[model samples]
Target: MSVEAIVNDVKTRADVVVTRGQEALEVGVKTLKTANGIVVEGVQELVQTNVSAGKELSTLVQASVTKAKTDGLKAVASNPVAYLPEGKATVLGAYSESLKIVSKTGDELAKTLKSGVETISAKIQGQAPVVAKARKTATKTVAKAKKATKKAASA
Candidate 1:
């Protein structure tokens, strides 16, 4: 084959390689987006689970306290001498304390979830610009390399 024909063939192969590289880059970008979506979904599910667990715990506490109150009231009525007025149990106070504890725990979980989401979003945002800059730099470098190759082949 002639020199010009071989040079043209090599250039064609190089162009094909560059095109494939760009395609791979695009695929990577898509994968990144998919990964981000998955992460967000996972975090949301975790937050929901946390909320559900808090609610279940609160329900259990309320049920147990209600039963205890019923039993105590019976005891006080049956034995007035043993259950003095000064030593009388306050059901409302117990329930109020339980509610406060549950509320505090739920609030903490919510705050943690919010903090985690903000961190993940910030990191994802931070990586995008760097990836974009790298891709731009790579395209420029590839173009320069192709130009140099063509010049050398022609000479």
Candidate 2:
């Protein structure tokens, strides 16, 4: 082949290489941006869920305390019989019920928080395979594009 023909061929190949490199760089940047976006969305969901759980827990705790207080007052309120020797059992029973109320509410709050965390974790896990598949597809497409461009340049 003539020197000029060889030089032109080399120039064409170089141009193809440069174009493929640019495409790969752009794909890399886009993949990173997409992954970061997904992560940010997942984190936002987690934060929102946690906030909701906290509010519900606060409300439950308040209601439980209020009920305990109201019931205790009612049990001993303005009753001479309540303070008499026969009223000790009544007072102790009210206190026991009050403790049971607090314990049950505390257990419920723990379950709520646990359920919230598990839901968030499940959502995060759910997004993973999708992102992985997207990345895999992108990688395959980039590879195919590179191969086609190189073949066209050679021809």
Off by over 4 Å in 1: 2-4, 69-155
TM-score of every model versus the real structure:
0.37, 0.40
For model 2, how does the per-residue alpha-carbon lDDT over 42-111 read when each residue is reduced to its tens digit?
A: 3443444345445555665576566556667666565534333333444455456556544543443344
RMSD of 2: 20.7
Tens-place lDDT digits, model 1, residues 33-67? 44344344334434444554566666666765665
lDDT of each: 0.49, 0.49
lDDT for 116 (candidate 1)? 42
